[model samples]
Target: MNLHLLLADDDIDDCDFFKEAIDEIGQLTLSILNDGVELMNFLLAEPANRPNLIFLDLNMPKKSGMECMEEIKSINKLKDIPIIIYSTSLDRTVVNHLYEMGAHHYIQKPGEFSNIKKVVEKAISLFTSTNSQLRSKEQFIIYP
Candidate 1:
């Protein structure tokens, strides 16, 4: 199965770095969205091909990540897709709030390329593993 990733960040450098890191870390097809508006549009336009993981930056033009999270969770169809907040902020309250608001994971943007790769790998693994377990249980239940 192909793992599709949606990157929602306004920082050009960070976006480029993330793409390189993801390429080095694993095999992933990523869709780039510079802001939350585009992110939502992409999701809304292609519901069938919804990204498996979303890397969202808290700060961006057009719309913020927090606002996007609220919108995403309110929409039933988009709620299940795992959202990973990838930002530079170290605010505990913001992190906690995002978690409460249905963000699947929160990751502080790494300063180094290597760290970025490590974090990406971890995120991808967690996403795939959890989904795999869910699928396994689902299959057993349906077949048994």
Candidate 2:
């Protein structure tokens, strides 16, 4: 399958690294959004071209990823699309909240390029292997 992925993050270097990893991973198309506001605009404007998955960063300018996720979940048109929290924070409290709020999965951003690939691959694998949109809380967080 040709997976269409959307990633929303503010850091230019992280976006570059993620794009590189996706290229290496292959079998997928990716869209990179610079901030939360841009991500919302892209999603809202392109209902016909919805992504298979969204990898969202928590700390972003304009609006936070948390805000985006909340908004995405509230809308009937976008709620069912799987959201993977792709963030640098390992704050357990926040992770728990995201899981409760219907985020499909959580990934604590790894420091190394190889680990980024690993975590991204793991998230995709989960999507392919399961029919359910949400995973068990025990399995919510992907460890790098």
Candidate 3:
């Protein structure tokens, strides 16, 4: 099945790497937004094009990922869309907070291209599986 994935990140290189990894995986469509404001606008404006999954960066311009998460979750129509926290930081406090705030998963940005591909593929597979269920905090992070 084809999965529509949306990424909200400020770093161009990270965005490029993510796109490349998704391309390698195939059968996925990706749309990227550079900042939290743009991400929220896109999501709010196009209800018909809501993605199956969203990858959000913690630190972003205009608004932070935490703020975006709060807004998204507050909206009834957008609340069910799965959101994955994709970031370079691995702070336990932040990760825990995100999980509490309803992020579906957390992925630490991998240093290697192959690792990036592996994590992305794993996330997609887990989300698309027939028996897939929202994981508990103990099982939230997806490691490469």
TM-score of 1: 0.88
lDDT of 2 by residue, 1-144 (tens): 999999999999999999999999999999999999999999989787789999999999999999999999999999998999999888989999999899999999899999999999999999988975657998899976
- Which portions of model 2 miss their true places by more than 4 Å? none
Any runs in candidate 1 off by more than 4 Å, and if so which?
A: 131-144
Evaluate residue 55 in candidate 3 and report its C-alpha lDDT on the 0 to 100 scale. 95
lDDT of each: 0.80, 0.92, 0.91
Give, for candidate 1, the lowest lDDT window spanning 10 residues: 135-144
Better candidate number, 2 or 3, judged by TM-score: 2
Best-to-worst TM-score order: 2, 3, 1
Estimated TM-score for each candidate: 0.88, 0.97, 0.96
Question: What clash count goes with each model?
Answer: 0, 0, 0
